[model samples]
Target: MSLPPSYLPAGGPDPDGAAAGKRTYGPDFLTALFQNPLDPGYSDAAARRATEGRRTGWRRGLAGGSSALTLVVIGFLLVVAYRQTVAEEPARTKARDSLIAQVQNRREGTERLRAQADRLGDEVAALRERALGGAAIAELKDLEAATGMAPVRGSGARIRLVDGPTSVDAVTGERRTDGLVKDTDLQLAANALWEAGAEAIMINGQRLTATSRIRQAGEAILVDIRPVASPYELTAIGPDELAEDFRAGYAGPYFETLQGRYGISFEAAEVKDVTLEAATEFKLRSAAPSIAPAPSGSASSSGPGSPAPGSSTEGGR
Candidate 1:
């Protein structure tokens, strides 16, 4: 039998060659494997050999089931990992918002109470003045001035302290908290103002009395237990040279150091009239008359007595 001309090489096959040119591997092998049952040589042996080329139905089913199971397990693991790693941001945000609302509500309530207390104190003072007469009224005025319970207005200085610019160090890549104003800084500033002869000082509009406390609560600066944010505006009523005096005092070198080292901002200016509101009246916890007892045998007469008011020296006469 002769092979087709197309199958032969360019030179054509040898006329009586014992063997054909190396059969170039082609689609014929696959075609033979899948030949129809009606084709020649489709005997049991051919059927068995063709069956070997393809997977059995049971093996195909098992492989498909395994692949599906693997995919399901991978999906489940991915879901678990996502849940474990990613926080529920929405819930956290909601909680944070709720806490802020609560704090605001409490602050509002506190302010309302403070205002009520101030009004009540004013009423009490008015009543006392009406009942006690002019001498008592003058005494009360002096007491108010001494206790910082009277608003004061005079030529003084205004000191402004602000948080410095937030920046990252180029070389170190470290975030600095020094730029943020601290309670200690405020306390020191107030002390400096006092030392500089500040008669009255107020921080962020809160009058500072003898009992006022300036301290830190976490990241907030608290003045008299009230949180005050920067830039803190501290006003003091004193001599016109108060600002200059403060600049000349220890505060000068201290603030300079802060500005140079930590970048804290400090500014002081003289003002014609800076007013500070009265501080809340402090309730006396304990008190007693400060007057000492008169000496024994000393007469309580108004002056060098001619006689006692109701007695006479008739016996001597």
Candidate 2:
């Protein structure tokens, strides 16, 4: 068919035609030719190349996305594994450190105790050697023989201040234990024995020392801070005359008077060779002989008497 001359494309320009701005197609003859259908052979090889290029590009894009996903999954797994290792490490370290500390402490304690035990063994052997040997016993036996009294041992009389006696006004029987042994009575007896030269005094099997203090427990009189129960039998080892004289001057009179007034029993057991052991002394935790360590970054001289040992330097009481 014959086409009009005006239908021919013209004025072809740059890749992005300047006149194409604001409008996709130009207002000229070229714009009218594209409105018609294209020939079937126009884009045979170019169309194939374009379709294959698109397929290849899509495949490359899919491969890149899969690689990125794999990397992310691996990173996540690595993070989880690292966290698990971190979590397990501290516990293992803690257990190891604790076991080490325990072993170290036990070793140190054992060493100290072994040293103390060896010292105690030596002390015990020396004490056994120094104990009243046959010679020492001879001196004591001679003294007793001259005094006309046989020396006794193995067992002796033990006095205990039990609860006081109950008194119903001595007639009412309403039960008033005020008549029972009192602290004053026990103290008087203990004082009499001490003044009479008691070698050893105890209450409830507890040895009374110089620092001992007597107290009351219920109706009973406790000697040397050790609670004892009933009929306190005090003993003294000395010249039988001194013991007798001391009691005749004090306890004898008191016991006789109290016995008659309260109808309480009074008895005595004279024996020799009474044995008493020393008390166990405990360390005081709160009391520090030396000043405590000062805070960090402080002057070495610190303040005078800064809680170090020998700070007090005071003479004994």
Candidate 3:
């Protein structure tokens, strides 16, 4: 109380006096503390509020960091789940498709057998017109008796056809069988063998008899029960050189032109006659039932008995 107030530094003001003057707070409080530590708690409420604010800031920071970590973990889990799901989807679809196909084929085969049984009389009548009398009828009876006696893989060459699209050249604009093996292709190859005097033919592992038709299923070309694929190799016992020379000149060149685009391999060989048993079932399509005697002067069967010198399905698969 003594003399007058003391002098403060050049940039400083009298701290005690400043506090005593009013309840100064906010930035001013921090300023006052640094200036004079001796000063009393002039802004006690403000001091308490600052302390609480600092604690709340730290707590909020921790909460935000924790939240971010949790989100990251959840995201990681979701990504893993998504990958696993994608990987398993195709396998499951393929398995399901395979099961469905098997079931359908078995059903179709069963139905075909039933139809044959129903039309037995008509089939025999058609056969009579063909060469069904005497020796032919006798052969039929023998064949029927021999059914399921044993599985005999007859002498024949394995003819195969693979997936070759229309024009391998995207620009050629040629007609192709959609990258799927065609019934026509198999038929043609087999026909060539027959023309070359082939006794029998097998496509893939399946035996091709009078009634077998090449069918496309999924990615396969079915010859009866056997499946065949591209750049088909057809074997005939009569002539390796003959078949090669024939196709090399006719279908062979055409095949090379086509394969030049798709890249398939074609080969033919001569072997001993393959011994394949008669097909367990035959599919008769014409109005003429194959087993029936010929309808009085209907002409020789254009059935298995006749081979098309030309004309067959194109192949891709």
Each candidate's lDDT (Cα)? 0.75, 0.56, 0.57
- Model 1 residue 183 CA deviation (Å) reads 1.4
lDDT winner: 1
lDDT of 2 by residue, 241-287 (tens): 54556546666677666666665566555555675444434222453
By lDDT: ranked, best first: 1, 3, 2
Score candidate 1 by lDDT. 0.75
TM-score per prediction, in order, is 0.50, 0.39, 0.39
Candidate 1's residue-wise lDDT over 1-317, tens digit each? 87675576446566676446644343465676687535565576588778786666998899899999999999999999899656676788889999999999999999999999989999998899899999989988877765677888788999898887777878999875667877766766777787788888888888887667776677788877788998998898888899999889877777777777767788989989667888864555776765998999875532111222444222111
Poorly placed runs, candidate 1 (over 4 Å): 1-123, 169-174, 280-317
User: lDDT of candidate 2 vs native?
Assistant: 0.56
- Model 3 C-alpha lDDT per residue in residues 230-271, reported as the tens digit of each score: 656654434445555546545566556556756544555444
Backbone clashes under 3 angstroms, per model = 0, 12, 45
Among residues 3 or more apart in sequence or in different chains, the pairs in candidate 1 whose N, CA or C atoms overlap within 3 Å are: none
